[model samples]
Target: MTKERVLRFGRAQHLIGVAGLPAAPAPTGSVGIIVLNAGMVYRVGPFRLHVEITRRLNACGYPTLRFDLSTLGDSGASNESQSRAQQIRADVADAMSLLASHAGCTRFVLLGLCSGAQNAHIVAVDEPRVAGAIFLDGYAYRTLGFHLRHYLPRLHSAALWHRFISRKLQAAANQRGDDVFAVSFPPRDQVRRELTDMLDRGLRLHFIYSGGVTRYFNHPRQFRECFGRLASRPEISACQFEGTDHTYALQVDRQRLLQEVEGWLQRNFPTSDGSTA
Candidate 1:
């Protein structure tokens, strides 16, 4: 049976997350890793699709935690404007510490979409718990671009969104992470520099973009070129999917995106080694 359990929980004023335990138990003596979503969405993007893989990873003896960084999901404050990229990194750091101290997961594995993944690299290098990482369809941090997902219907299932917001809002009175996306702002090259520096450290990474969303990047070719700039280091792995956009249109289909990251994760982990690092 596919099941999800909340281990220890915390918040970011807009974002909040639970140390997660999948239905299947992890193998004995193996540690767990956490998955952080991009843009403060729910823990159901590429993170959800690969639940089974992670379950198997855990069953084979590695546990995993999938959660929201801050204003993206249930992690932080709503009106608080927590989307500042810096804050998101802070939230991820908090989650990593929580995972290591409370949940006993010293080894952290992180994956982020677009800006989330970009932020993941920052956190991975800043904190030692992160051993491996995956950047699902990441792009170079830009100052301006068509943020379709901001207005489009790509944020995963909407059925429970209202309810979740209602409940979380009552508890905190205001949210933190949502505001990051509420207002669009100019990009800071320094953030890009920080992220580039992190990539140089050889963080195991996988960048996957869907085909459908390829047009947004002026077609996949240009997207890849810009992506290459962000990941300018030699030790990174990247790919493009056939039918996804900024939010990853078919990301959850049959583990579409997860398959790409499998190699990177394994290479980082002596166990999940694929064609990476």
Candidate 2:
């Protein structure tokens, strides 16, 4: 059994979080896990992904915290004079500090989805205490392979071509912007450099993509194609669940994701000397 408690921390107690404590003491060198808010979603994550993840990790003798960034979910607004990115980084750092004090954790593993995943990457790069990061539906960029795979099939279908042409004409007539969420990723070069640095420092990074972002990422090997030799490094790993959307809306998809996460943690962040929890 695991115990969970609400925590209020950060400057002026602006941050709110729920920490899942393991029934037993965490093993030596165990890394605490933090689940950040997903996009504009609350700390519980899309469909309560954060809550489920925290419970699983806690059951495995790992302390897990699911927290809201300042001004999101149940957390209050921050008075810090900083950019949004800086504020997020500071919020995560504060979460780590709170986990350290409450659970005696020295190392940490950060996990997030979509926008939250991007935040995890940023924090992992600068925060030395972060031993690993799991990014779900994270940064992606188009490659030549992506173009070939994405467009080649449609080329043979006359109906597809007509629809495409019609859409193009409609778009030109409307002159309207795309109905997409305004999410920005650092330049590919910057991401490559940062990932290279993280790998050099022995940081464990896992990038998981879902079918929801197929426009930017499609195949399993797309990550390697985007980063070249940097992706082949031992510490870096990636996978894609083609059947699932960005949010894992279906119960089956969520279960599959949970299993994958549990397996990754067991393989990479074992609880004991030779066995995992």
lDDT top scorer = 2
lDDT values for all models: 0.53, 0.86
What does candidate 2 score on TM?
0.91
TM-score of each: 0.60, 0.91
**Candidate 2 lDDT (Cα, 0 to 1):** 0.86
Model 2 stretches astray by more than 4 angstroms: 158-181
Separate clash counts for every candidate: 37, 0
Task: Report the C-alpha lDDT of model 2 over 1-277, residue by residue, as the tens digit.
Answer: 7889899999769999998877776666778999988888888988888888889778777898999999999999889789987898889889988888777788899999988888899898888899999999888799999999879989799997897789679868976565333377889999999989988888998998988888699999899999999888888899999968888989899888888887888788887765543
Best by TM-score: 2
- Across 1-277, the per-residue lDDT of candidate 1 in tens digits comes to 3344554444434445554453444333234566666554566644355354455444433456667655455554434544566676667676666655554555667766665666666676576556666765554432123344322443675754675577568748756555432323235456455556556664555566655333344233443344446644555656666545455445374366555555455555643332111
